[model samples]
Target: MTPALLESFPPFNPEVRLQPPAIERWRRGTGTDVEFVHVLDSGRPGPTAMVVALTHGNELCGAIALDTLLRQDVKPLRGRLVLVFANVEAFGRFNAVEPFSSRCVDEDMNRVWDDAVLRGARHSAELRRARELAPFVDAADVLLDLHSMQEAGAPALTICGMTDKSVPLARALGQPETLLVDTGHAAGLRLIDRGGFADPGSDRQAVLVECGSHWEPASAEMALDVTLRFLRHLAMVDADWADAQLRVPAPERQRLVRVGEGVTAVTPEFRFLVPTHHLKVVPKAGTPLAEDGGRLWLTPHDECVLIMPSRRAGMAGQTMVRLGRYES
Candidate 1:
């Protein structure tokens, strides 16, 4: 269904700075049944770590990082290192002029991970692709799904879903100054929140890294840095080599941001009080943050911090922005 809202209140057109990396070279399967999925088996027993990129086609930074890693022939030293280029059909449609339109072919791939959606009769370009990738995703011991924000100048952060297992892992990564602990979206379950990754009793772990703005050079750099750190953390790659590749210095300490609520757009007329609201904090409770048609959306608590405020057309049921607070 077409979204009820078809326009950004004040149209947002950010400059596209980074070129999408040429990924046609990695299309062929590398001894794996899945196309664009390469596995580096160390032949030694250890964890199966999977790193996925291009969850959103417009978010090219992760693809750049994965392409660079594949070009360098980085092999695992422990168990298997699974490198995935997801949503390639949508990625193939990426046009520099209209980048965001290609986020998915039919629907957002990130939201189709629920078991019923994966197993049911729902048909979409993303769902079919998700089904193909589900087996590998389920087998992973540690999963790192790379993504980027729509808004520029937003801080790099990690989405550690509502799991105790992931928060410590995100903290240990030591980059990306902020960490978000929240439940999976009401729209659908994200890949990180699927299967054993979200199970407290299971030892499996997953974290989604929002490197930075979609086309920024820094976002690509951050993606590669986090990729190296993730592999190093699992001992899948050499610590010294990974350290040498790291360009960004780790923050002295990371802040935990627990999301209290996600304001989902219910009407076509959803518009923020200001043009941009990423990381903006409302000092008082009940301050009007946005308006959805005739309904007003207010801050539920004092010092409500907005995270990843979307500039896209407010589709009904889409999360406009998440309200959160920083932990000391």
Candidate 2:
């Protein structure tokens, strides 16, 4: 399906539970020369850790959480802390009446992270912003890109993009119960999958946190809790300060969900057999899940779990859902 055709689908009309925080105060950052990028240096030498929000403009939970941290004047004790409000241009377009319309102006910002794509001739609002943010991303030793889901009722997950280094970082956060390990979309590379962040040998690691449903108030709290835990793990922020902000108890053990395959829509006629929630486990192999152009898509393995089943209109090559299995 064409982009125009996909966009013709109805606007998302979910009830707005989370209020979008006013970020005018943070437009000009201290320390970092860049706009909307705040850098806090402790003067003592340590790894630079970054927390990025608003990759998709409609996802407001991250924005709220980041704004809270900035307002609190949460500074690192040892290393540098970089708090970024990315895709602000797109974020400026967000409206409660039509939240999904503001996802991007040109293209998905998360998809254009490959070196060739950034250095190549292709230009868009997202590409230009990614290019501008490249320097900060390159310098970071550890990073957290915060995001939210389109579908509600899905459990929060930390997406560790097919790298061993990121696994421990996700484990360290420990609030989000599931850890999703994948290479990323077939469309292009994600920020977490870009350059040294995805390299196993490199100390640099990045994990994208899908906090929860876009418009849910709980999602914002989840984002804040996870962000604090991440900073505490890196020893960037004081333990007492970080602990005071947490609203949820840390998970005793995190379940590892290794993505087996992404079910991409081959035709626009993709339809799920039943309404499914995220982490919905199918007990048997060959269980019918979806249908595409008269062909039935079944579960490939027993105890198959569905992750992030798309509620939006499916286009050709778009990920309709992801199938995964639990690891030890």
| Count of backbone collisions within predicted model 2 | 0
lDDT of 2 by residue, 69-167 (tens): 988888888889999999998899999888888898899999999999999999999999999898899999999999999876556899998866799
Candidate 2: list runs displaced more than 4 Å. 1-13
Using Cα atoms with residue i matched to residue i, what is each candidate's TM-score against the true structure? 0.95, 0.94
lDDT of 1 by residue, 69-173 (tens): 999999999999999999999999999898889899999999999999999999999998999999999999999999999886767999998766798888778
* lDDT scores in order: 0.88, 0.87
Predicted structure with the largest lDDT when compared to the true one: 1
**Clash pairs detected, candidate 2:** none
**TM-score of candidate 1 versus the correct structure, residues matched by position:** 0.95
